[model samples]
Target: MFKGLRETIRAYQERDPAARSGVEIFLLYPGVHATIYHKFAHFLYRHRLFFLARFVSQWSRFWTGIEIHPGATIGRRFVIDHGMGVVIGETAEIGDDVLLYQGVTLGGSGKEKGKRHPTIGNNVMIGSGARVLGSFKVGDNSRIAAGAVVVAEMPPNSTAVGVPAQIVKVAGERVNYTKELDQIHTPDPVSLEIQKLTECTRRLEKAMRELEEKRHEDI
Candidate 1:
């Protein structure tokens, strides 16, 4: 348990440049505190102490503002930065080295019996305000852009952006250009579509001008 706590602290330090020291993280980081609470709650849940486990999870939510179901399976080095309003539902499975920013949700789309929530793969980075709904697998080394709404499964090493999330980059190495773990400058799908339309309009105008010049030459 101490080893896991130590590793969690280390992960926070490594991933977040704003973290000054281990003591600071232990004292001030609500994400870490939520993870610690979930560990014990998960243990109780496994032992069939459902009420107790839920109580702990609810208390953690009240304190941290991060709602993580006790039944959710979380692997090592899972980090949630600025973790307020982050929600991980029951049956959600999160792999190691996954990073999630604030306002991210791993939730079910509708009422389901089992395996309702999404499964997050290793080395995945989910940006702020992203909603990964339904029982889908977000592949390893993938990045979900800020405010993206992903309802389908994502392939490995892909970058998804926009509402209903479209893949922009795939089969490439993960990128970490800044310590803030931001995606503010990532390619915008809406802008790209506008640019394509602008180019098409320019070509049509040029073609009409050429046709007019040919008619004058014929005259």
Candidate 2:
């Protein structure tokens, strides 16, 4: 248990440059506190102590401003940065080394029965205000851009962006950029498509002008 706590603190220190001291992190970091609280809550939940589990979960949410259901399964090195307003639904399964920023939601679409939430694979980074709804697998090494609403499944090493998020980068050879926290560098498919349309319109206008000039000369 001490080892896990040490590892969690280390992860925060390594990932967040703003982290100054271990004492500060232990005393002030809500993400760290939430995770620790969840461990106990999860244990009680597993033991069929539903009321106690919920009470603990609610207490954690109130104290940390991060709502993580007791039924959610979280793996090692799960980092939630500036974790206020972050919600993890029951039945949601998060793998190791997953990084989540503020306002991220791993929620359901409707009133579903089993496996209603998302299953996030290892090394996945979900940016701030990103909504990953429904039962889908966010594959390992994938990055979900800030404010992206991902309703579909993402493959490994891909980058999802835009509303109803589209996979901008597929699982293949590309620039080896490892920093998943680079949310600003994510490609916008909507903007790219708009640019293409603008270029196409310009080319068509040029062709129309050329044809009109030729017709006048012929006359």
Residue lDDT tens for model 2, 38-155: 9999999999999999999999999999999999999987788999999999999999888899999999999989999999998888989999999999988888989999998988
**Can you tell me which runs of candidate 1 are displaced by over 4 Å?**
177-180
**Candidate 2: residue 68 lDDT (0-100):** 94
Tens digit per residue, CA lDDT, model 1, 1-219: 998889888988988889999999999999999999999999999999999999999999999999999999999987889999999998999998888889999999999889999999988899999999999999888889999999999998787899988887654666552354666767787888999999999999999999999999999
TM-score of each: 0.92, 0.88
List the lowest-lDDT window of 10 residues for candidate 1.
Answer: 171-180
Clashing pairs in 1: none
Angstrom error at residue 183, model 1:
2.6
**Would you list the clashing residue pairs of candidate 2?**
none
Q: Candidate 2's C-alpha lDDT?
A: 0.90
**Whose TM-score is greatest here?**
1
Candidate 1: clashing residue pairs, number: 0
